[model samples]
Structure formats: C-alpha cells, structure tokens
Target: MTQTLTLTWTTVCLLDRLEPDRGVAALVDGVQIALFRTADGLFAIDNRDPVSGAYVLSRGIVGSRDGVPTLASPLHKQVYDLRSGHCLDLPGVAVARHEARCRNGLVEVRLRQEG
Candidate 1:
C-alpha cells in the first residue's frame, strides 16, 4: 500500500529567486522556515538554530555528509541533515524538517496545521 501524507503546501517564492546549494528564509504559517536548493533538491527546515536559539539557519552552509544533504549552523557550525533534521554535530538535538519543492517555477513549502 502507498502511504500519503496530509499536508498544506504554500508557495513562498519563485525558483529563480533561489540559487543552487543556497538557503533562503521564509515565513510560512507564522513560522520561520529556511528553504534550500542543493544539488540533491529543495529542502525546508526551521530557521532557528537549536543550539544558539537564533533564527539564522538560512545562513548555514550546505553540503553532503555520508550521502545525506546537510546544513551547518552559521553561528556554531552545528550540522543538520537536510532530509531528516537530525543534528550531526551534537547528537539528540535536531531542527524541525519541512517539505519543500519547486513546481512550475515557484517554490512551495508544506505547513503543519495547528490544532
């Protein structure tokens, strides 16, 4: 059986606005989200760094580690898996991951609805 994820996709920006292997910050559903377009694909995660508590993940470096796309925190260099939001530098710490993609020249991100 195929599994389906229930999510609301919101268009944040145009694909042309983003450069490859770079991150851009966007606000979706009142939450700060960092969007990245790497050689692998587009990925979205919480903008705030779990360690420093600063909203600056958008400035993080993008690279691949062990075949996983990752974003390293600019403030303290805490690396996080872009696909799973798992912190590499420090175990047991992680940022929230989101679904982000480019469609029809536009960037769209998934937002989790509040109860």
Candidate 2:
C-alpha cells in the first residue's frame, strides 16, 4: 500500500525579501529550506547538500541548465534543478523539493510531516 503524505504550510518571510536570481536559507519548523527567486518563478528545496552534507545550498548560484532553472552548489559545484531537485553532475543524487508560494505577500512553504 502506498502511504499518503501530509504537509503543513508555514510562513517563512515576506516575498519581497527574496531577490531575483538568488537563494536564501530559512529554518522552517526546524527544517532547513532553501528558497530561490528566478526569472521563471520561486522555488524551494532542501538546504542540505547531498555531496557535502552541509546546509549551504542557500548560498548556491542560481542559473539555468538547458533552459531549466538550476542551482549550483557553492561548496562542491553540483548542479541541481531548482524545480525538480535533480543533481545534474552526478546520477542517483537528488534532494527534496518543497511546495512554496506567495500568499498575500508572505512566503509560505508546505513541509511534509516527518515520520
């Protein structure tokens, strides 16, 4: 049987705090989430680096990979799709992607309930 996932949305900050083409790390309900603003839209992902295992993805560079918005790790240079959290440099490596949106100018993130 497949288990259903439950999410709890929490406000991170004001949407105006996010700068275009940049990433910001926010501790949301004890989880480190990396928020990004690009020309396409806003995205959120796990702040931990799969390779380095550090909370540094928030400082990663925002760019594009084949027209897809991508975030490159500043610590190890691993490219990850901001929307899908796919690691481009290495296979079988990926991070968690979260649902984020602007609700009344406030940044809200849907965090999955931990087991």
Candidate 3:
C-alpha cells in the first residue's frame, strides 16, 4: 500500500449544483478527481482512471449493480466501488479513496494516503 497523503479538503462545487446521477471534476494537488452525486443524494469516488490514467472518472456514467453504487471509467468502462475504491471488474486493483463529507452545507473531499 502507498503511504497516505494528506489532502486538504476543498469545496469544489455547491451541493445544489450537483444533481443525482451526475458528477463534477476537481483537481486536488494536481490529481484529477470526479465527484459524483448518486441518484440517492450520496457522493462517492474520484475520477482518476486507473486503467488509462486519463483522470476522467467524473465524466463517466453512474449506476448500480446488485444494489452497489458504481462509477464506470469514461475511457475504458472500468467500474470502481464508491465506498471501498475497489475495482469491480479487476481483481487486486484499487483506486484512491478520498475521505469525503459534508460540512456547513458544503461537500468536501480529503484525499488521504492509503496505508
């Protein structure tokens, strides 16, 4: 596992701006990430495409399989787990999971280094 890097949380957009089944992209320390608001009003995953390194996860589609929320890569259709950063279609592969929360009516993502 890679050492966790402390990512200062930044409010990329307003909660009202993000609708269900849509996403927006933000750069946290040169790392491109996609923030998704699921159909259920919950947020998950960053848009870094591990398979292609395109950093276009935010532009990908959002949906669920077996009731698990998933984000598919825009470049390659690789699906990632929003909660665990696990790649659903690839074994032994994972993406960087950002610690995200809402505070003061704003959504914030803290990119922590994985242990």
Per-residue lDDT tens digits for candidate 2, residues 52-81, read 999999999999988989999999899998
Let me know the TM-score candidate 1 reaches against the reference structure: 0.89
- Least accurate stretch of 10 residues (summed lDDT) in model 2? 1-10
Clash totals, every prediction: 0, 0, 3
Best by TM-score: 2
For each candidate, give its TM-score against the true structure: 0.89, 0.92, 0.83
| Model 1 stretches astray by more than 4 angstroms | 1-7, 113-115
- Considering lDDT, which of the candidate structures 1 and 3 is the better prediction for this target? 1
Off by over 4 Å in 3: 1-5
Candidate 3: 10-residue stretch with minimal lDDT:
39-48
**In candidate 2, which residue pairs clash?**
none
Off by over 4 Å in 2: 1-4, 113-115
Q: What tens-digit string does per-residue lDDT give for candidate 3 at 3-24?
A: 6667688776667777778878
Residue 67 accuracy (lDDT) in model 3: 86
Clashes of 1: 0
